[model samples]
Target: MKLTTKGRYAVTAMLDLALHHKGEPVSLAEISERQDISLSYLEQLFAKLRKAGLVVSMRGPGGGYQLCSDPKEIAIADIIAAVDEHVDATRCGGLGDCQDNRRCLTHDLWTDLSNQIRVFLSGITLADMTERADVRQTAARQVKRLEMVADSAR
Candidate 1:
């Protein structure tokens, strides 16, 4: 499936929030800095996430965004879908119209592949991803790099 930057970045930002939000909200700027995503873009994504009931926002100083539910309850597929992304591998987008208004020879094959991918992603959650050794290591590195950048600027 062709997951776009929107899907990838939404997952990355959510994972960052799950990793860092220890009973507190995490700012979009923090996710933007750690994931190398633009703040404006993050704002857009977070808006959609909030509307989807996956996240909530706060105002005033010391305020930011927090997960609306447990990370384990938030599936990767849900995040992708919240951002209006599809996990289709078919050239016809599963509409069976790949060739001149008709189903192509491999339409079923691609459709089945898309279903498998959706199911695979649906089984994985932000909490599950946060428990990975590699995810922890990568988050640590991103935090260290951000710290170094802040120090250099001072």
Candidate 2:
């Protein structure tokens, strides 16, 4: 199933925090700038994440927000569920009673796919995303440096 912008932004926001983590809180504006997310939206999402215990907020000059636990310990599902109200992929409305709803021929398929999606998302963590992002950043930097050297040589 396709993920919405809310889910996508939540992941990016968490990754921003993971990248700038220095054993202290990071301001929402900092993460907003880094992720290119609106400060107001970040503030809204952060409130939900805080309530979910995925993040903690501080209030002061040096206060902002921080992950409640290590990135590795925080699953992608946690972030998505925190920011987005629902994560069900194949449900008609909610996850209550879809088995007995007549005319639902693909009900089993939807249910199975939902389970797979949950497993896949829960298997990944914020730390995994951060590590991959770091690798991509380093590779891009190297490519840029190589291109600059080639241009200078030419």
The numbered model that scores best in lDDT is 1
Off by over 4 Å in 1: none
- Over the stretch 1-154, how does candidate 2's per-residue lDDT look in tens digits? 5688888898888877887778999999877755668999999999999999999998989999999999999998888888864556565744545557653667667767777887888999978877796745954565467668779999
TM-score of every model versus the real structure: 0.98, 0.79
- Candidate 2 lands at a TM-score of 0.79
TM-score of candidate 1 against the unseen true structure: 0.98
Clashing residue pairs in candidate 2 are none
- 71-93 per-residue lDDT for model 1 (tens digits): 99999999999999999999988
- Report lDDT (CA) for all predictions: 0.95, 0.80
Least accurate 10 contiguous residues by lDDT in model 1: 56-65
